[model samples]
Each structure stands twice: as C-alpha cells, then as structure tokens.
Target: MPPIPIDNEGDPRLAAYTSIREKDLTSGHGARFIIEGKVTLETAVRRGRFALESIFIADSRIEPLAELLARVPADVPVYTAPQSVMDKVTGFPMHRGVLACGLKGEIPDPAAFLESGVSAASTLLLLSDLSNHDNIGACFRNAAAFGASAVLMDAQCCDPLYRKAIRVSSGSTLWLPYAQGGTGLDMVNAAKAAGYEVWAMTPRTDAASLTSLPVPARLAILLGAEGPGLPDEVIAACRAVRIPMSEGFDSVNVATAGAITLSHVFTAAV
Candidate 1:
C-alpha cells in the first residue's frame, strides 16, 4: 500500500503518536506501545513478537527507508508527515523520524510462559523491583546479547515495552521471550521448579565471587533494583554470587552488573 500522507499534527489518525513524553509519564500507552528510530523500528518489523498496528514516519524518510519499508506487511498502515509536524506531534525533535505502534498482546501466565519458553539447559535472567526504564532496557539487551533463553521480571519492574525502554533496548524487548508479573519469590520458585539453578545477584560479603562460581547447565540470575538490591530472604533462597570489584567498591550499576554476570554465563555455556 502507498504511504498515507499526514499534513497536520492534529490529524486524528496520528493520535496515538501525540504527546508521547506525557503519556509515558502518566497512564502509559495502554494496550499499545510506541516504537522509535530506524534501527528499533527495523527490529520491531523483523524480530518483534508483537504485531505492528501502524507506522508513522517523516515524509523525507520515505525514499531512504524504501527498502526497509517494503518489508512491512502491506496490510499495516504507514503514515508519513513533514518533519516539523512529526516533531510537534510527538513533543520531541523527531531526529530519527520514524515510529510505530505495536499491540501488547495477551500476557501469558508467568509459570506457563517459563515452562513453555525455556529448555532444561536454558540460561535465564530474573528481574525484581527494577524501576528504571533504562536499566530494564539494558537488561533485555544484555539478556539477548549473551544468549539467555528468556527473561522473567517480578511484578514491580517498569514496563520493558515502554517507549524509552524499547528504544534503550535497541528493540531487544520486541524479540526476547519475557514474562512480567508475579512476586519476586514467585519468580524464583518458578525457575527452581523448572529445574534451574537460581543465583541471586548481590554485593553482600558472604556471596561467592562470580569468577569462582560454576555456571550450572540451567541457570537463572536474579537482579533487583539499584539501592536496596535483593531482599535478604530472596538472597537466602538461592546461591548468592557477586562480581569481584576493586577494594572499597562492592557494587556496579544493576544493568552493568547484569551484563557482567550474563557474559560469564554465556562464556561458560559456549
């Protein structure tokens, strides 16, 4: 189908793309979430699990992105607007000049999702109470980059499908099989029941150094938010491991720590 032309910022068809920053801060994108940039939009088209509702791009991008746009299913609407209108509509500069909206789809039962999505020897990342969108995005990127089979997040995590999170992830959240819901302990127990060797990532002195810990055939690394880290009971429920850091520095950014640990697991698995 030919691209639909959008001339005005108030075009009702572009309603989903308007005031993006405000929507992200408030009630959120609801059943639909926005995708940003060429690379992330490409990821959404090729590898994303969710269905694309429609695509909105700057008019100037039409020719440059022609080949990529050809890959989009013809049935999905593609809207093109002037760069000025695009910026006004989205409440941002519209630098990359591309966006898409995607359906959230039905969230599966967390336990069933793990049981069906993972193998007996799978590597997994379990997240708990991570409120930062960037950290959530980075975790998905790390999980995908390091060959983790799936990611499981507890009830308190920020939405990985949030616009900024999706962009920060470079769209990994679109492809990586992940389930978000349930309590932290519920996540741990689900992984344990699935026969995974659950490891709580913490900086506590009693935790074993990651370099010394053996990677199990089936491993789940659980990470919590930055400040409080994992709860004491949660840490006690599993094998505890810490990345060795220099004297007087026991911690790293949670996402950075996740990347380091996932790298260790990926290295061992290979």
Candidate 2:
C-alpha cells in the first residue's frame, strides 16, 4: 500500500494516533493499543496476531521502512507525516519514527486457556497485583525466554500491551499467550483444577528454597508485585518457593527473581 500523506494532525484518519501518551495512561482507547518503536511495530506486523488498524510513520522513515510497510494489508492505512507533525500528533518527540495502532480481541477465559494445552504444557506463570508496566513487560519477556506455555495475571496487574511494557518486552507481549482478569486465588485454583501444581514465589524465611524443591510435571509459578509481595493467604494456598540470596542481599527485582526461578524450574523440568 502506498503511504498516505498526513499533513494535518487532526485528520480523522489519524485519530487513533493522537494524544497517545494520555490515552495509554487513561482508558487505552477501549480495545485499541498504541505500538511504538520500529521493533515492536515489526513484531506486530510479522506476528499478525492482533488486528493492525493503521500505521503512522515519519516521512523520513517511510523510505527505509518501505519493504516492511509493503507487508501491511492494503486495506490498512499507512500514514506518513514530517517529524514535526508526527511529534505534534503523538505529543512527544517521535524518536522511533514508527507507531502502529492495534485492536485487542477478547481475552480468553482463564480456565479454558489453562486447560487448552494442559497435557503438553509443563510450565505457566501467574502474576498477581503487578502494577508497574516495566515489571510486567520484563516478566513477560522472561516468561517467553524461559518457554513458559502461558502467563495468567490477576485483575490487579497492569496491561502488558501498554506501550512502554510492549517496548520493554521487545514485543514478547505480542508473541506470548496471556490471559488476565481474576482474583489471585481464582487463578491459582484454576491452574490446580487443570492438573498443575501451583507454587507461590516469596522471600519469606519459612519458604522452601527454589533449588531444593523438585519441579512438577505440570507447574504454575505465582509471582507477586514488588514491595508488598504475595499476600499471606495466597502464599499459604500454594507451596511457597524462594530464591536463596547472599546473606547481605535479601531479594531481587520481581522480574529478576521470576527469571531465576523460571530458569531453575524450566531446566529441571526439561
């Protein structure tokens, strides 16, 4: 598809690209999400999992991204504007020179998602109350890297499709299968009913060291947000596992801790 020239920031065609920061912070434009950075845009285009509504690129980037842009469906609009105009539309310095608007489909039911590949899946992750976008994104990246079958998040976790989280994950959020929206207990019980042994991650003194525990055939590792960590009741519901740190250091970042545990469990299971 030939690039459509976009001289006016207020053009209805570019409505999805306007006030990106504000929209992302607030309602996230309903089911739509803004994809920033060339890598993320390329991932979204290549994966074709989500519906690509349109693309907005800086005029200077159009020529360089010509081959990639050609891959987009003809029906989808590809709008190009000067850097200044792009900045004005997005309300920021458009350093990446590429942005895309994608529509999210309905999230699958948690039980169905967990049961779909139960027999074949060895590992899964449950995120509880993780509000930080960067942490959520990093955790998704780690989950993808470690070969987790899917990620299930409780209602309180932040949206992985948030622009910053997507960028932080290097687009892994798009590649990974995930379902969110449920209470912590609801997620844990769903995994249990699907024949998975749920393990809650914590830094508590009584928790069994991760290295000391044997990985189960079907495992679900529950990770909580930073600071408050997992609630006592949630931890008590599952076998609590902790990473052993040096005497002086008590804990790592939630993403780092998740990666360490994932590596241990994935290696042991395989």
Worst ten-residue run, lDDT, model 1? 21-30
Q: Across residues 22-120, which tens digit of lDDT does each residue of candidate 1 receive?
A: 885223343888998999999988888899999999999999999989999989999999999999999989899999988887665458787785444
Q: Extract clashing residue pairs from model 1.
A: none
Candidate 1: stretches off by over 4 Å? 25-30, 117-121
Off by over 4 Å in 2: 25-30, 115-120
Candidate 2, residues 53-88, lDDT tens digits: the string is 899999999888988888899999899999999999
Model 2 is weakest, by summed lDDT over 10 consecutive residues, at 21-30
lDDT, candidate 1, residue 71? 94
Q: Evaluated with lDDT, which candidate comes out highest?
A: 1
